[model samples]
Target: MRKPRDYDSELKALELKARQLKSRRQSQLGELVIATGADALTSEELAGALLAAVTTHDHAMKEAWRKRGAGFFSGGRPGAGDSAGREPGGAASGAGSTPPPSSEPGAA
Candidate 1:
């Protein structure tokens, strides 16, 4: 005969796993914010900027923004573009700075 399943223990284990995943996600987001130098802005400013990006539909503008974002993540300076009118020292200032400390307590 097969052994009975411990449903209560299984449920608790699943909940714990979910909590761990959530914590990891928050930690990663915090790191991303600092890495992008977005921590300089207030939450409202960040939300507004993201909302604007989400709502924007200009193909050329979006393409340019995408390139800038790709460059930012690839260890290249932002706005180091061939075109004109880009910000002088926008995201690049923070991109090369030291990474922020981890948010997790007791992290080395």
Candidate 2:
């Protein structure tokens, strides 16, 4: 038979779990901001940079996800332009590294 969990211990464990989740969120956001430093990469270039930093996903899948994500943000709205062709600066963006000028119809 399994031992019943004590209420006090259970509450403590729940609190610990919450703390862990919060810590993870904080680190993730920090990492995200830090990843893009300087670069003129298109959206795809940015994602490629981030993807290079982590050994999480297969190359093909990562590219596919990046493509899908860019589409989600731009949608079919007009003036999407080069944004449609690029991704944000992931791990490669740095100071002075700006994306190319947008190529939308009327983005002057």
Candidate 3:
């Protein structure tokens, strides 16, 4: 008769692999944030921006972003007018000139 499979060990191995993959994904996302110069934003601002992007229903805006992202991955310079023909605040904005939120009094 064939030996029974070690389901418990296989399950544990799969769980470990999942955790490792998740960690790698998070790291890559952090790197991408830095690469895109979005690291300048505070955590709150970043989260808000991501939430907006995720919740947006504008197909045209999403498509423009997708094309810009494709250009970025295909060796295009970051913020180099790759988003020409996009909305006014697109590519040329270059990571935004607005200062990050400050904690100090009268900072604004």
Candidate 4:
């Protein structure tokens, strides 16, 4: 006759693996915060800033941010202009100055 499987041990191992993965994810997120220099902000301030960025609806603004983020992930330094064909702030201003305010209400 075949022996019974140790289901309890298997369940315990799976639970431990899940906990380890969750801890690693939290650690990685902390590293990202520090890398971005956002660790200087209070938790509330960081959360608010992230909320604002994520909730922005301007397509051009989102694209600009996307390119910057991609560059960061691709090991390109910030402000390196890797986002071909678009000069920094050139989309909104003639002299690469700050972009104009979005038409969206409550946008900064």
Candidate 5:
């Protein structure tokens, strides 16, 4: 009767107070952990959200890795396929075949 109703109100008040305290303490509270009454989101929603985050992070990481890789080759921007053009001494770039030692060494 009245006792049961009072207990319900007290429980509701305590739950609300705890939620308020938690919200005040956390910055990511803007994102909801659960709905008030609706069923939890489906696996599809969770997967899609996770994929979007991964794709964004992956793209950013790839751009950074590319920049670092380009820097490794040129110490600056790598030109239009210039990394494949030629070496400093113009030997078709890359670790080319090391030429054999000269045989006619001072005619000796």
Candidate 6:
């Protein structure tokens, strides 16, 4: 006869894997924020901007944003022509500043 499977252990393992994946995603997001210099924004500003992005229904705008994000990953930061993260008529913000220390333990 074949051995019986331990369903409870399998379920627990699956849940643990899900939690690990979620944790990794959150860490990557935090890294992305820092890498993009968005960490300079206050918590309220960041939250509001993220909310706006989430709620926006404009596909073209979303595509633009997506392309810009792809540039960040493929190239370095956005180019001089890119205006997404700049202040109006001003030099790029957060250009040469050090990012604040991360609160998470073991974060570099």
Model 1 ranges off by over 4 Å: 59-64, 77-85, 88-108
List RMSD in Å for every model shown. Answer: 6.6, 14.3, 7.4, 12.3, 24.0, 5.5
The CA root-mean-square deviation of candidate 5, after full C-alpha superposition on the true structure, stands at 24.0
C-alpha-based local distance difference test score of model 5: 0.48
Note the Cα lDDT for every prediction shown.
Answer: 0.71, 0.56, 0.74, 0.66, 0.48, 0.72
Candidate 1 residue-wise lDDT at 102: 38
For model 1, residues 1-108, the per-residue Cα lDDT tens digits are 999999999999999999999999999989877766777677898899889999999999999989877877777753333222356545453443424333344455
For every model shown, what is its TM-score relative to the native structure? 0.62, 0.36, 0.71, 0.60, 0.22, 0.74
Candidate 2 TM-score, true structure as reference: 0.36
State the lDDT at 8 in candidate 4.
100
- Tell me how far the alpha carbon of residue 103 in candidate 5 is from the true structure, in angstroms, after superposition: 71
**Candidate 5's residue-wise lDDT over 4-80, tens digit each?**
46888899999999998887867333332221110133568656755765667577777875665567556453232
What is candidate 6's lDDT per residue for 1-108, written digit by digit as tens? 999999999999999999999999999999887767676678998899999999999999999989878877887664333544464521333442332333344474
Q: How close is candidate 4 to the true structure, as a TM-score?
A: 0.60
Candidate 4 C-alpha lDDT tens digits along 36-74: 445656789889979989999999988988877777777
Flag the better candidate by TM-score, 2 or 3. Answer: 3
Ordered list by TM-score, greatest first: 6, 3, 1, 4, 2, 5
Error of 4 at 22 (Å): 0.5
Per candidate, the number of residue pairs that clash is 0, 10, 0, 0, 0, 0
Best by TM-score: 6
Better of 3 and 6 by TM-score: 6
lDDT of each residue in 1-108, candidate 2, tens digit only: 998869999899999999999999999766544333323446686677677758655888778867755764566422323333474532233223333333443466
Residue-wise lDDT of candidate 3 within 13-102, one digit each (tens)?
A: 999999999999999998898767677668898899999999999999999889878888888755534454464544434445223323
